[model samples]
Target: MEITDLTPAERRVWEAFPRGDGVDFREHPEDSSVDGAGWGPERTVRAEVLRALLLGAGRAEEGRVAGLKIKGARIVGSLDLRYAVVDHAIRLRDCWFERKPLMYGAQLKALVLGYSTLPGLTAATVRVDVVLRLSCCRITGPVRLQGAKLSALFLQGAVIGPTAGEESDEPPLQLNHVEVGTDIIANDLTVHGQLRLNGATVGGQVSLDRARLLAPGGIALHAETLTVGTDLRAHRMEAHGMVNLTGSRIPGQLNFAYAVFVNPDGVALRASSCAIGEMWLRNCPPVQGLVNLRRSQFDLLHVPAATWPEKIRIDGLSYRTLAPHLPAQERLPALEREESGYLPYAYEQLAGAYRTAGDEAAARTVQLAKLRRHRRTLPRHGRAWGLLQDVTVGYGFRPLRAAGWLLALLLVGSVAYGLHAPRPLKAGEAPDFNAVFYTIDLMLPIIGFGQESAYAPAGWYQWLSYLLIVTGWVLATTTAAGVSRSLQRQ
Candidate 1:
């Protein structure tokens, strides 16, 4: 087939493709206005001509290392290359497209549409040998790349969303089940709809640093079961809706430092059952809604103090270590915010972490707080028993309180027995009527010091002896129980 009848603009690109050279049609950068509004046909290139050049249509005389690189052209018509095998790299910079570039199931070296304006993209299942970049491009519709394989996918500083008054039922950026070799760097990406990354697997990192997801009161970023070999950094990213990462496995760190997730009506972050290594939720504002970390496991969890939101679901959430190594007092408040009601496992998990850190005192504090929270849901009699245990034994967390109770009881008995004298049963035969010894004998159950047997208390003093005996038995039982618990914990 003879390659003739090419327009002056098309001829320039055709001539440059053989030498892997590029053709620039614009007088200045972005010389073609957005959407190619008011652009003349002189700077236009048909998609068919560009596609023909990319498919090895160039003459054999002009030859080696051929690629297609064009800039600042108004591309008319759909650039469809579905299922075609193109062996050249195609890069169109600062260009305007009349329609979405279609590359579904196509095999290519690279497809870079940097700083271009297009409706959207449909490159699902396409395999790109090198990077597939749409950096700083303004896309007006959804971009789907489900099950695609790429070395890298860079959408840095891109604005991908629907046009004004366009209904956003579908996600604007879809990378479902994508297998990327290196990374998906989308820093400073602005999307007006959800960014779906369901089941995507990345070999390296996935950075959404400073990205703005503006889907308010909806699912902003849904990445369920996403597997990242390394870190998933979303530092300072802003999401006006929920960021759901349920069941995702990020072996490397999931760093969300300074990121703001706002979804007041529902869950702000639903990261249930995720297997994460070191999650940093540091130095951010209070999450607007419930943060669901249910059944999730983390190697390390880093959070700032007093920034916990009012609602949380942390049942079955386990972490090995906490950064900043805060005491139980600082971290216990987060457990209290569980919206689904108090879970003893949450407290136990916290207490165990403190114990692992060799902070027995902090562990006891956490256990004490757990008892208090548990006591609220008890029956009337159960609550009364709990109150007695708390006041006298500090729920086994404060064993010193039990000693204090014993001292107070002993003081009361001593004062009562000192003021009153009990007549001796045997005249001049019994030991001397020592008030302290007799009081000790009366209060201590099953331990006779011979003073009680020698003396006979008449009138109200006898009744006081009985009262002291009962009080002593109760105190001894409670103290024994509390001490047994303390020993077991040790």
Candidate 2:
């Protein structure tokens, strides 16, 4: 606290604190700094000096227009200001800190540590008026900002947590229950541990485009129950662990295009119960685990055919429209990836989408696919009946097949009876033998032409007549049953 005890470098910072003048020691730190140790006296500033300056030690009233701005210096010792209220901006860019700053429950104007190297940050429940910018910082420990309220949080290109393979129990970066006013942008950010944002309420968008979240065999991003006012963009992000967004509410687009996931936990992305707007999984690489999107609702889904993961739990995913508008055949394959087993509503949802697009044929195709899947779960007799309907009339989806069967049967009956004509009944009085009309009447089951009634066939010919009648009735019954079932489904 004595002026005579202060070093030459510390004395300069002490004299300039009141005016808030920025102190740039030199073009670079005096010497090659090593964790606030190897730096010469020129660039090494004691944390007590900064704390004294921030606490208004030697402040002057005349030139009190600025905050504290120190660049390229190595701050040694703890800048401990726990629960203190300070109305000044702290900009320590391109600096090295020996010990992490402790600002728990402190109220500050701003804290910008751009391009600095710090052990970690712990500012739980802190209130900042302006912003918290840690852009391009290399933090070696967990950065906890839980329950903090700030205007904006910009972590662009920052690298947090330990180096790869040094896994820790604590999450590397956590902003859980934090409230941001504008946006929380973290593009190109890399975290070696789980990045948690559970219960975060963001007024604007939260962009994490091209961020590398690496926490192997564990959760990479745990942002459940989040409330985002706008978009939550994570375009092209490569996550090594499970990204769980179980119950988020993002009214804007939730984009994950061109992203790659490699989680060994059997599940990659879990976004169930999310009421999101447009969601994009387009152009992304094949995921290694199941993407659980159960009970999620989206206005417009932008999952192209190529981006669908091989396994999914899409039991209750409802989307109004699909991007690229592929036909049902091309899109139905995605529904097959649902590992939660047969779900009729999922098929109906797809069919409804096609119907809304005015593609009834495609809709029918989806319905048929659904029935085929249903067939696998049916009993042996039911499956046999389903197979018959499928082969004969495509479960009433292809009525032309029924017509073709009728035509082929009529021709076979006509050929058999013509080659072995039945003996005439009431000789000289019976109607003339018309092979086509007689075969048609026999197959018709109800309508009777005079030829079939007036003639009598003995032995094998009589058996053939009975066969034609039974075949006609079976075809008609199966066609009617299949058509009725199809209509019932619709």
Candidate 3:
């Protein structure tokens, strides 16, 4: 691509290219009056000029393009570099584009479009060896990076949405299936539409710190099935709609501390089936919607006990450790804070988690709380019976409770039998009427001491013996069940 092959606008841009020693486009000029100072006089360049530059860079004798700098210029027409391979950086600072640059399937070293305003950007299937920086830029239309492979993507302080008075139906940013070798930093970004990163893979961290996303009545950030090699840090992030991270696999920590989510009638954070390292939701603002963590697994969970949403779903969540430790009295109530309050397994799962963490006392407290809540769910008339069963046998959690009840019943039966002694049923029946022995014989339904058959209870003592027999059977069955559960947990 020679100067003769360039269009009139391209020819002017080529003529204006700063030629001479010590001219670097990679570094911003210090002098404000310079041509490439980034805030200097605006220059209009045709898309053909950019294509010729890339071609010239590819065919350079040294195999390196020194600098391709264009500042404060309005790039006319769509700059299509699809499949064009270049080995140098392209820097466009404080420039405006009439249309989005199409870089689909292009291979480049690096791209810097900082402080620029563009209609949109399309880099699907494009591969960059280094960073792609769009910091402080304003995009009017969607910014698509689907299937792109880059080292890092920096959009810090960028504004992605429809321009004023323009209506957009598409998402603000789409990174679906994109793979980044390093990080994706979008700190302080303001996105008006959904920011979709579904199926994306990041080798390093995905930091959206202090980002503000607004897509009311819809999803604000959808990163389902995303795989992040390192931490996914979203501290102080403010999202107006649902932020779905379902099925994501994060090998490092997921920190969302001090984040604010506001989807009143829908899910605020849906991380179902996700496998994350440490999870931090501590000090976050009260979420208006549900935080679904069903089937998710994490090493540690740090969440505010009282600030959780009323409709949290933690059916199969398994966290090895929890932070901000509260006493059992406080922890048990926190587990029952869910609206509808019918999740028995949720309590069991928490208890199991506590037991796994070597907190048996806390686990037992959780189990007791579960039994109390379960009793409350019974019918009004059946509540008393359920409470009795729970207190006497811990609803099959405390086998010792059955033993205590059995001893009390045995003592009462013995005292009654002693007061009114049994009489012999037959002549010279060996008077097998020791009060303690008679009581024991009645209590043990299967193995009798031969006293119950040899003697008969007088007056109301017979009814007392019948009560003791029924109580013994109930206690025995409950004790067996409780022991089985304890063994299984161990």
What are the per-residue Cα lDDT tens digits for candidate 2 across 12-88? 77777678877886554542223445567888888888887777775556746657888778888999878988787
TM-score of 1: 0.96
Candidate that would win on TM-score: 1
Estimate the overall C-alpha local distance difference test score of candidate 1. 0.87
**Candidate 1, residue 105: CA error in Å?**
0.6
Candidate 1 vs candidate 2: the lDDT winner is 1
Which stretches in model 2 have alpha-carbon errors above 4 Å?
A: 26-37, 58-64
TM-score for each candidate, following the candidate numbering: 0.96, 0.94, 0.79
Q: How far does residue 175 in candidate 2 sit from its true spot (Å)?
A: 0.8
Clash pairs (backbone) in predicted model 1: none
Model 3 scores a C-alpha lDDT of: 0.80
Q: Which residue pairs in candidate 3 have backbone atoms (N, alpha carbon, C) closer than 3 angstroms, thus clashing? A: none
Superposed by TM-score, candidate 1 places the C-alpha of residue 91 at a distance from the truth, in angstroms, of 0.7
Q: Write candidate 3's Cα lDDT for 1-490 as tens digits.
A: 6677765644555654433112122234432212222432235667776777666722333533355666666677888898898765787777778789999899998899987888899988999998899998888889989999999999999999996667787888999999999999999999998999999999999999999999877999999999999899999999999999999999888999999999998999899999999999889978889888888999988886776888787877788777767666766665666655667887877777677677888888788788788887889877986776677788777767787887888889888988888787896855657888788888877877888888888678888988888887777776676677668767
User: Which residue pairs come into collision in candidate 2?
Assistant: 19-63
* Each model's total of backbone clashes: 0, 1, 0
lDDT of 1 by residue, 1-490 (tens): 2457778788888888888888987887636437474567877988999888777686434437888888888999889999999988899988999989999999999999988999989999999999999899999988989999999999999999987788867899999899999999999999989999999999999999999998888999999999999999999999999999999999998999999989989889889999999899888888888889999999988877655678888888999887768978889888878888889999988888888888889989998898889999999998888888888788777778877876776787678778878899999999988888787788785788899899988898889888878777877777787778878877
